[model samples]
Target chain A: MSRRPEPVQVVKERRDAALDTLVGGLPYLAFLGIRFERRGDELTAVLPFRDENIGNPLLPALHGGVTAAFLETAAVVELAWSQLWPQMEGGAGAAAPGVRPPLPRTIDFTVDFLRSGLPRDAYARAVVVRQGRRYASVRVEGWQDNRARLFAQASGHFMMPDLSAGPGAAFADDEAMDPAPPASEPR
Target chain B: MSDDQYLRIAQQFIEALPHARVLGLRLLSVSPGHAEIELPWAAHLVGDPATGVLHGGAVSTLMDTCGGAAVMAHPAANAGAATLDLRIDYMRAATPGQAVRARAECLRVTRSVAFVRATASDDDVERPVALMQGAFTLHAPRLAGEAT
Candidate 1:
């Protein structure tokens, strides 16, 4: 993958503004208190725990569904901010300072859970392993210990549309998306 | 003779399932030994071009639901079992706008857990869009009804 032309340095004002716009409409992560922090080459998202986020009542650990959602959200958001991919609804200008015009869709994902994330804020960082105009793959690491102890992780394959006809800056006009519904099993 | 008492709960169970509400999966039918779920088209939920085909994640969830229900119908004491591992292989894409259906068989269900295999298809069950196999733990006691 010829490194897609590196983007210009995202200035503070521009960066924060873009992030705020991108993060606002995501109902799922918002409910979980997921927030983003960007340094060079790396993107981070945090999940601040809530009482209702627990399922097993006994262990008081973050529910598995919540953990998986955190991992998926972080991976997709990382793709958005990293410029390797764009948010499904967001484009180059409003979400990331220098991201390319069109966004990539998550194609495939695999997640592994190492430890239960107890009730508290959980931190995650994602890195782009390979990137191309057509497809981009990323790996996301989520941790509760603050140092990457392998609490949860996921990797996804994504595809994007051609900018000439795809959803453009006008995407900003739509409201933020609600958190996607839970997994619907057969039965 | 009760032909299929578990049939009603089978369908209702999917509706009451918290995750199903969260994912937007709709229940189509739940009969004596069969069930089906539908995933309406949503760009974010799709993986391949089957624009209307159910998202792979949605398909996985449906498969689990079917497996869980199979265990629940078996007269097992425990009706709870967490998915330890789930694996799916995507074959073909469902038609855009058409709803995909999954038919699963309770291949083998034991006292501690059950194993199931399912196939997803657009128009033909023989020609499946995807195939899934999974194991579900029967958390309920050893008795739900007759052992399967």
Candidate 2:
């Protein structure tokens, strides 16, 4: 007889799949070679270094705009993951793994350059300062080599998607019809 | 510097930045305390594939670079400068397939800082896609015989 999959295992798989889909949906993120690593509900964004990402050839530093983009991506992805976590854990109102909620729209973002972003693989983590039904505020810190020595930090205000309209209604125009799975298999 | 000389220096300055090349940012005009740059639409820069809208990050990059160029062009801030803090507000999605232009002005320059404001617009100049304000650290030129 075949063994049935445990309920906890099924939930975990669904959550993982949804997270992948969410990140895969953003084409610009793919272009920048940004990936996410999830540990339980926490997520860390990684930006693999490429020559094209260099701004100052003399310093060989990562582009300041690219660094800001990385931080913003981290904040957006973290917010989405956090929103999906409760639904997955409850395992009741969960949408299918392929069907994701609309990505939040950024209202304003502010980035502070603490140091030059070294030309190397960089990492970032975002903290949600406030999350409400209509608005959310997130802060992100990016570092290379050392987590304590942040090269840059950013704060963003986002206008949350209005989910009350219906499933996928808010993002009907923006959602990618065919979100290709990431090229690299998840480790 | 003559207008032609200033233009050449600005173009060279922009070309030196690798990220500007990747984004296809072209210098349109530059004068003391003012600069304008343009980014032509490309497939790789699309943020929303379904809507064909350019990504906000692309716009941010353009505005940031334009702001820096403005700071660099300022008579009082001809030396190197780095962004200290930048804030951007998105007003609406950019019209797809249209080249976006960013114009920035250096509003003020203090001893060690320069203030800049910028706006990104498409063909419709009346409504801008985004607005930005930033402060940049003004680096003093190296003096003769200074340690490298």
Candidate 3:
């Protein structure tokens, strides 16, 4: 019998694959101009400001929704990067056929607007508070110039899939394939 | 000011935000202390492409816009408002191929703050996809003699 890849190795592979396709596979994040930078195991979300992201044109502040969305995406992407397995509804072997890695479902989200987000490059940092068998909790904070001067802080809960339970479990998803072409390319 | 004037202001407020336009949010109607907005579905906005469901962030945008609009339409709000805090509970994923509607009401208004409660649904109002509650910070103080 071929030796099965350890669950930890599988998670690392999945995390690397997700980073490669972070843009094309996730179209919405691209639309919002969200990018990721990984340093060792830490992931930071970068949101470059565009005219479309401005909420208060007068103050030239980023839209509350834009900030919130950035924070939420940061939380989800961080969870995946950390390779925390959420319990799957169907068994691990019951894999769905797709190239895009399965993303956790958001159960609850709360955002606190600490300060108005100025129109500029914004960055978010997310930390997974806890990872249980079926659910995971994450805390994310967004800032512009000074990290201490946080524009927004958020807490969210996501449902994870159990990926370590079965063989071929982690590599079954088509997301294991190379990244897709850019959105501009024809399907 | 009259509700009609406040309604017009609310519409302009929604139009001014480019992100709101990106989501294709339409102002359905507005009355004093209340606002309604609609979001048309698009393929690129889906959070879960496998399931083809709208992303939670899109829903949050819709709800936040409505909540802010409700504050703008409030009679006591002489100036615009900003979101102080917002909470969303995802009851279920929004069905794909359906437009989402969000309606928010300013439950109360004080000198410097306005409270809002809102909901987002696709076809059926009874079975909502998400629920939201938020508070907005009023730019100006309450109008004279306005209800507390």
Candidate achieving the largest lDDT: 2
**DockQ score for model 1:** 0.07
lDDT tens string, model 3, A1-187? Answer: 9977558765656555546653346767877888888665678899998999887777767888889889999998888656532222123511332344556667799999988887789999999999886689999999888888787999989877555544324333323221333458884
Worst 10 residues of 1 chain A by lDDT: A172-181
Tens digit of lDDT per residue, candidate 1, span A1-187? 6766435554445566666555554444554567888664356788877775553344445555456556666766776666532432233444334333343455555555455566678888878788776677888888875573667676766553444444443223212211112337331
- Sort by TM-score, best first: 2, 3, 1
- All models, DockQ values? 0.07, 0.38, 0.31
- Report fnat, model 3: 0.56
User: Which window of 10 residues has the lowest lDDT sum in candidate 2 chain A?
Assistant: A173-182
Task: Estimate the overall C-alpha local distance difference test score of candidate 3.
Answer: 0.78
TM-score of each prediction: 0.57, 0.87, 0.80
Q: Comparing candidate 1 with candidate 2, which one achieves the higher TM-score? A: 2
Model number with the top TM-score: 2
Error of 1 at A177 (Å): 21
Model 2 bad stretches (over 4 Å): A1-11, A171-187, B1-5, B140-148
